[model samples]
Target: MALASALAIGLLISAPGTSHGAGPRDVAGTRHAAGTHHLASEPGSPRTVSTGWSVPWGLSWLPDGSALLTERDAFKVYTLTRDGTKRQVGEVPNVVTTSGEGGLLSIAVSPSWNADHYVYVMHTAAEGNRIARMTFDGSALADYKVVVDGIRKNTYHNGGRIKFGPDGYLYATTGDARTPDLAQDRTSLNGKILRMTPEGKPAPGNPFHSLVYSYGHRNPQGITWDAQGRLWEGELGDQTYDELNLIEPGKNYGWPRCEGSCSTSGMTDPKRQWPVAEASPSAVAYADGAIYMAALRGERLWRIPVDGASAGTPKAYYAHTYGRLRTVESVPGTKSLWLTTTNADNSGEGEPGSDTVFQIDLT
Candidate 1:
């Protein structure tokens, strides 16, 4: 077991209308089921589930409960079971690394996988970033088809995470691609949360009449649906603040115009904001009435209790224990989470194959 760090840092949660500076410890009207920020199934000590991974970026479970995992730099995919058995399932084709953040990234299994064996992926390619679909029968992957393309790609901000929302539409997060202006342009796919059909068409009922579900995002990497099927997102701010936003369709999350919280009309503010030093959040997963956010630079896990549209005080866990966390996914049907590390990547501090996945049982 990895040891938790001795440095336990306390961070005040920033309110939506507050200034860029830090706010009080708790948001005024936030409510919790347990009358506090802690979850009933509080996270226990982590158990190492698997090892020998290099920059594992995305994870999605098969109908059988075995998960499909992706290695960012290597363009490979593997199937990992709860028993810690792992096997290479396939390798994504035509995936090119930006030598930075780009490569084969997030993957999502078809919600109706038993009927249709389709798996979706978002990766950086030669022309740009593309959301593609492939056939994953049980053991291998094939039949590569591009679902959406033309998303801009830069070395650092290729915001790559995809999921099939409770509404049965595919949702993807794209970065600003180093050009912050693209965030505000609804025509561009970059810096937007895109909602699309399983075939890559724009999802019906979308506010913009296009794939753009919500616009004006800087580098949003994490997206998840709460118990009420409400969407939530985690975005990486440039220098000042990182955000945990309650996502709404057609809303504008001010990027170049506003970083954390601003009085800018028509722009939606984050539910909670944190200093960039504490959260370069890569992925978020909802389980047991809270959202588990995996931190990259912060090297920790954050648990934020949620009640409807309001968020409570944020709590840090496993601080500095794992090197650089890249992904956190709630284990379906259980009060547990599967967490991955990105320490093998360029910005991380560990060597190749130094990353591992831990199963954190919530007690």
Candidate 2:
């Protein structure tokens, strides 16, 4: 459980698109390593934590172990306690939704929240998508300041997930903004995993001499660090594939050029890949020696085991049982995971406030 260098580079394996227990059959003709396989039983069911939510998008814990949660279209932030009590804290101002995906998206309580009382959020503004900071006194929010901006926005592809890494630096995921070529452009902030200081400046030792930590991502929406401080990401691919990548500084995850696994030189392959039909992944959380990826189109939670740099076969849980999983987050000091549904979102076809949050206890 030692922490690795934040800038260290590593490689992961490739896996096929398979739904282990429920829904549909495994996708054939997808390229993967020989040893990648599936398990038979499904993970246990989750206990409902709360209900009546409308598109809850992000969840991050405060110093006291309670979590701060965000609603995408409402521009509202709420605090959820351990006993299932939910209270509205504040609403992010100047936020605009694309009527599709953009709005108040991700939240991360500053690592030094005890001293700084700072909270950060990624949201869509009039000009573009922004990473902003504000004061959270454990009771209310105030004093907003824009830390990072200029990430282009689109109706559907505005990638938005942010977390403070084990290195104490801020890391964010971004989409290509519907422009495929931008994923390959190192200069563009779109389609990249960015590591930055709390003040929005590029972190030291970044490969590109800029904020970009890794490039060539299509619409990456999930990122988390393992017990060893290795970063993992989940992305939405085009028509063919979705990706679960073991992130490394300076590496390029093939996007427009390669969908899943390809022999193309210089572009890194994913630790696991799934057909777009089986995995439109959103948020990923690391817990109990595995990465739990929340799937949208697949409507399942994928648990992929990890050992150092290698990823094992993915196992699916709660397939089609909880309409459109959106986010999965590890509880700070427990063997539990908090999961959210996106059933109230535009693509879900459910009534507003139909979304819910659940706690999945790992054995």
Candidate 3:
């Protein structure tokens, strides 16, 4: 595996609580058209809330406002109430998760979850890294099947983010799995974002006519759609920098060959980047024209303003105070965000707890 330290073999900069990219308006919810939105900064302190978990990663808010969170080590998804009460929904099927960054990773509500009650998960299945759908009947699940399989695997770099895009299709992010060369291989699912249907087939009209929606990624964990339906993603870079990018379906995002800002003539460049040591970005939330990030090593929530396709400077908050942040979800019907921490990670810096969830008011 190409170590993040390997990328830092040369002159690598390190700081904490910084990241790079965002949307249409700005942080104050001002509009570019009406001039209401403007750039937002984390000048004020973030009000933190403790979730109380063991290594939380991805989280999805159910229709009833309950949440479902995945744990990388536990290989289980826990259902929690608004008050943070917890219950073990069930275990991820067919996973060994024995070392090397493989395990139960991320979860997404079926775009049709309201009707079908299906939840999709991305995990290190025994068959390999794969995507699967399981039905949650409030207490337990009965139907679980592999929707998509055959991603590369390794001890680390198992990019395992999954979400339902605004287009009503399923999208997944993959890690290079230490196979830098595979990132350049379109035929390989490693290091790419795949777009698929509910049944796991490639979405129709895809540029590749295959599962790949975009390629040339290292290991991306954060992905969200802007109010305008444009897809943006947060990525972790090796030695040099960490990044946030405006995604274009089918675009190549210069990974192993390029880390921070892409200067290669044809490859896409990140909208923003930070020196590695300080920030290891994990998840993102796009709200009111600003992108909110959860950082693992940097241990803060980063705010980046979006003017359009490009982004402005980034601001950081709660540095070294929140431990290792894993995921940031924009709470529906509110200006606040739902933030989850990752103190239990074997690579983290502190003691473990419930991994706390914060309801932070962007206002």
lDDT of 1 by residue, 149-262 (tens): 999999988999999998999999999999999999999999999999999999999998999999889999999987778999999999888888999999999998998888
lDDT at residue 140 of model 1 (Cα atoms): 96
Report model 1's TM-score to 2 decimal places: 0.91
Scored against the true structure, residue 54 in model 2 reaches a CA lDDT of 90
The global C-alpha lDDT for each of the candidates, from Candidate 1 onward, is 0.84, 0.84, 0.75
- The count of backbone overlaps in candidate 1 is 0
Better of 2 and 3 by lDDT: 2
lDDT value for model 1: 0.84
Candidate with better lDDT, 1 vs 3? 1
How does each model score on TM-score?
Answer: 0.91, 0.91, 0.86
> Model 2, clash count?
0
Q: In model 2, which runs have C-alpha deviations exceeding 4 angstroms? A: 1-42
What does candidate 2's lDDT look like per residue over 1-363, in tens digits?
A: 211333221111011232246433434344545354333223344567788899999999897978999999999999998678999999999999999999999999999999999999999999989999999998999999999999999998888999999899999999998998898999999999999999999999999899999999999999998877899999999998898899999998998899888889998988788988878999998776677889999988887776778777777776776778898887766667788898899985688898888875554
Cα RMSD of all models vs. native, in order, equals 7.6, 5.5, 8.9
lDDT of 3 by residue, 1-363 (tens): 111221111100113333322222122221223223365323222344434577878788787867788888888888876555788889887876847468888899876776898999999976679998999877876588999999978888888999888788999999999889888899999999999999999999788999999899998888987666778898888887788888997888998888866558768878777766557889888766677777887876777766667665566766777678888887666555677877777774545564666665543
